[model samples]
Target: MPKSIKQINEKIKKGRAVIVRADEVPELSEKYGTKKTAEKIDIITCATFGAMCSSGAILNFGHTEPPIKIQKLWLNDVEAYAGLAAVDAYLGATEESLDRGIEYGGAHVIEDLISGKKINIKAQAHGTDCYPRKLLESSFTLKDLNQATLYNPRNAYQRYNAATNSSPNTLYTYMGTLLPQLGNINYSGTGELSPLNNDPSYRTLGLGSRIFLGGAQGYI
Candidate 1:
């Protein structure tokens, strides 16, 4: 039976769906044939992702007593963009911290926050008539924030670019240090568990596609 995603979703809701892992597709296809395998499976979980698919967090610090509009924000010594709202800021994973250097960044801050560790908070704002506050220095944990949302705009690509160094001397890059003369070829994404690879034709994927993002249920 040719089952559309809508049909599969209906089956899933009614407890009639059969799900399998992406890696299991080959064996099942060999055992039952491609057509039968396709008919039997309602969902194939493509369990994959990589650190290269770096993401960020949107944090709502909530309002302070007679809050001032924040112009600059820092979390755990990492500068977070606070141009959005009064207390809302975004902590990017790749953002480097002044104190920790490149070794520690927004990702570490997020990890620390999730681990229930205290993070230093600092902000500067111009005082207003109703909100008369200028400098705000504080500390917070993950629970302290009104909302912390994991917002990932980047994902591992199916056909990612390969980086290589052809120069006589070593070259340094964001991917890592590359030796000269093609000493290393860094493939950004290997396609394993990539949604595009799992659904090559994008058959079942569309607007509002459900996914597990950072271990949380989310949608595209």
Candidate 2:
């Protein structure tokens, strides 16, 4: 079951930490007959990863080794997972919805509820698409590795799958209260990554663990 913002806030205030299990599993089944026999059942396995979030840190625990090719632009699965978790902790810690800026607490609660592993994975992928621009623009030199701006550079990017490129999904841009006033958030044109695809650069970052936490700022 999903947790409420109030509940999550209390936990955070009390220094509550959670491990999010993103592993996709097969649906279980049960059988009943005239004999009324119950037996163990086996099912299929699916792809999924684990995520952990705390007031101070976030961790992405997975069976497979994360791909971290470029030291400058790439964000490992653990960093991606932690970054998103930190964002969520920031949101939950703020508790802005209690103010008059919000009319419906449910909306704020729902928004908080949806910010999880699924969104984290997507956001990580978006970060992957934006890595090149981030590296080129940041102060960190590719040669001298001192300041690690690669942790969370405040940027965003998106692209559609090749099969659906002709039609294309809704053009996405990064918009958040925490996000600085940079124009790098767009699908294309006027400060955007043009021609999106499942590029190898994304792989260089990692297997694309994307995360997203969406909503108008100041509301919640």
Candidate 3:
């Protein structure tokens, strides 16, 4: 049976951290000034967002402003299990589970999407340290699912489950660790809007649950 909004809301009220997966494009041509190609690009963009079908787990809404934290993870392979697989790999990277609570919560949330609601998000708590800095003030309104908020299936997994399309739940996780250690990406640049330099909008966006069950790549 499909889980009602009430059931999902109840979980959130009980302090269950959610994992919301925003749709990501394989490239950020406009942001990087690259042309559309047969392959993926280095960074993702705001335009290539899958907001409509992407799932969301509302933490709490009674606050003056909805606060949400989003953490992004990138994998080398876009086809791998980002949530489950990545979580297992990053376990040893940290000594404390709360510090690693994001991964655990993320994996469980993704599994919830696959297995449907009726699962427990309470036991998967990470001590509530990582909360989104803001709520999703999406461009989409009740009028209709705007094109800006439409969900696009960029891969096979999405294509198969078109009927049950929904936003992902929100959670926490780690990212960018390998970027510094691997040297695959460069953190030395100051652009008009760059996360590395702490762009206001970008930093304020904070982290989300582990949505990238795949891997991240770079262009030489």
Candidate 4:
């Protein structure tokens, strides 16, 4: 008999559902026939050893005693956009600092903050009567911030295209190092655990779906 949605959910809640890997379907099918395997399996898990995903974070520094519009901002040497508000800014994972290349980026700063390490927060502003502060520099940890959350506008892409260079010289692109004369092809995303790949027609996964984001439970 086919299991109902409620029954399947109950089995999952009780940890009694049989979990299977996508790659093991063939072996399991041979062992217990396709029908029997389908009846027994409740969940399928996909695996991708390495997958490149774009992500970023937003940080709110809360209100300062004397509010000043930030004209320039830098977090851990990485330039962050501060045009949203006086105390709001966003940091991207792949953003490179003007002083320090990719050696220290927003992703590294976020990791350090998560690990309870202090990071430098510097800002410059034009002095005003209400807010006379022209420059400010301080060190702050994640706990010190009013709010910090990952806000990746585009996380897992539905699909991606591969790239190759036909130029005579090598090219250093975001896609990765491209060899000269179409020597090698570059591709990103492994398809495993991708929301779109699993739900091609977008039936089960939809708005407000729970997702694992940056080691935390979030919703899409």
Task: For candidate 3, give the lDDT of residue 34.
Answer: 35
lDDT by residue (tens digit), candidate 2, 1-220? 3445476567667765342221211112223441222122111111211111121112232211232122221121112223332112112211223234335332233233334212211122232432421121212121222211112221223232121122223333222222233422322221122212323264323434443223211110
| lDDT top scorer | 1
Alpha-carbon deviation at 20 in model 1, angstroms: 2.3
Candidate 1 stretches greater than 4 Å from native: 26-40, 156-158
lDDT of 1 by residue, 104-169 (tens): 999989889888899999999988886688888999887888999887666634446578999999
Q: Which residue pairs come into collision in candidate 1?
A: none
Each prediction's whole-model lDDT (CA): 0.82, 0.25, 0.27, 0.77
- TM-score per prediction, in order, is 0.81, 0.18, 0.18, 0.79
Off by over 4 Å in 3: 1-56, 59-102, 114-117, 121-175, 178-182, 186-220
Q: State residue 37's C-alpha deviation in candidate 2, in Å.
A: 27
- lDDT pick, better of 1 and 3: 1
User: Of 1 and 4, which scores higher on TM-score?
Assistant: 1
Q: Against the hidden true structure, what lDDT does model 3 obtain?
A: 0.27
Q: Give the lowest summed-lDDT range of ten residues in model 1.
A: 152-161
RMSD of 2: 22.2
Error (Å) of candidate 2 at residue 153 is 7.4
Q: Which stretches of candidate 2 lie over 4 Å from their true place?
A: 13-18, 24-145, 151-155, 164-220
> Which order, best to worst by lDDT?
1, 4, 3, 2
